[model samples]
Target: MIKLRASRRGDGAALFDVWYRAIVGSHDFLKPDDLATIVEMVQRDYFPSTQFTVAVDDADRPVGFIEVDGDSIGALFVDPDMQGRGVARALIAATMPTDRAWTVEVNEANSRARRFYEQLGCVLVGRRETDDLGLHYPLLRLEHSAAAV
Candidate 1:
């Protein structure tokens, strides 16, 4: 069985490994150093342990995680081996709040992610260019409320 729980203090390094592997292992995303930097930043600042949920297997090993920044779904990742098993869905469902809308940026090149958000009633509001880390990526902002959409 799969269980969802809040992230723990000592789970930072393990979460980092999961985030790094999830990004770098994807042939379509970040390069080595970029993935490393992203993981580092998440571990140091963006993990949002207080507002994050980790998916654990029967053995209590984390298999996926989701981090929220305010109402925005900042990060969601599932271990490659555990993809398509409702891990991502459970994490997302657990993190969404009812009082406000949420937003997420999906890369245009990532069709699967775009479709996933769309299925969750997120609509593309606009596009923006992010020039962080010496790279420019076209990001699509998806919002979950009528006012935001």
Candidate 2:
């Protein structure tokens, strides 16, 4: 069975691998230099600071994770093999609060991610020309408002 649990310090390397694979597969619009820069930020800055809820398999290997800071989802990535198995949804649901709103920023070029967030009742609240990592990729800020629920 798949279960959700808090991420430990030892899980960083494995989570980085999963994140790399997910990004390489889904982020087709990223330039090589920009991708490298974002990778560094994810490794050095993003992962360390966020509160993560990891989706682990029966053997306790993480298949996906959600990086959240308060009510904002900084990132969500699933292993490429686990993409269609609801690992992302499980991770998000694990971290989501029933009475509060949560927000996420999806790459504008990633239609799949946009669709997923929209289906979860997230509305497009804003847009930016660059991602939070300072990469030049466009992003759509989405919000799941408590009042909208």
Candidate 3:
């Protein structure tokens, strides 16, 4: 069974692997160079700098992660192998502390992700021409009610 745990100091590599695989599976719209750059950046900077709540299996190895970026879910990615198995839902429910709403961003090219979030009761709130890094991937901003996750 899967369960939740706090990410520890040595979790970056596994976390990075999770992020890379998930992105590769869902973000097929990204260019090879852009994806490579993102992979490098995530490994060299983001994963180490950011703290995440990890979802682990009985072995206690990470299978998914959620990043709580203030009032937003900065990131949420589950292992492609674990997709549609409730890992993402568990992360959202565990991280969201209130019955109010919080936002999540999905790449505009990633219709599958958009539908997944919508299935969790998220509604369209806005859009962005590029991601936070000024990348070319347009983003669809969505707001999720904590009550429904």
Against the true structure, candidate 2 reaches a TM-score of: 0.91
* Winning candidate number (lDDT): 3
- Considering only N, C-alpha and C atoms within 3 Å, which residue pairs clash in candidate 3? none
For model 2, how big is the CA root-mean-square deviation? 1.6
Tens-digit lDDT track of model 3 for 47-83? 8899899999999999999999887999999989999
lDDT of each: 0.76, 0.87, 0.89
RMSD (Å) per prediction:
3.1, 1.6, 1.3
TM-score ranking of the models: 3, 2, 1
Question: In candidate 2, what residue range of length 10 has the lowest lDDT sum?
Answer: 89-98
Residue 102: error of model 2 in Å? 1.7
lDDT of 1 by residue, 1-149 (tens): 89988889777776766776676555366556665676676677766444568999998888889888888887787788888899988887778765578898877666788888898788898887762454566778988884433
Which lDDT tens digits does candidate 2 get at residues 1-149? 78999999888888988999999999989999888888888899877776688988999998899878789887799999998888887787778776888899888999999998898899999999987667778999999977766
Better of 2 and 3 by lDDT: 3
- Candidate 3 residues lying further than 4 Å off, grouped into runs, are 146-149
The per-residue C-alpha lDDT of model 1 at residue 13 equals 70
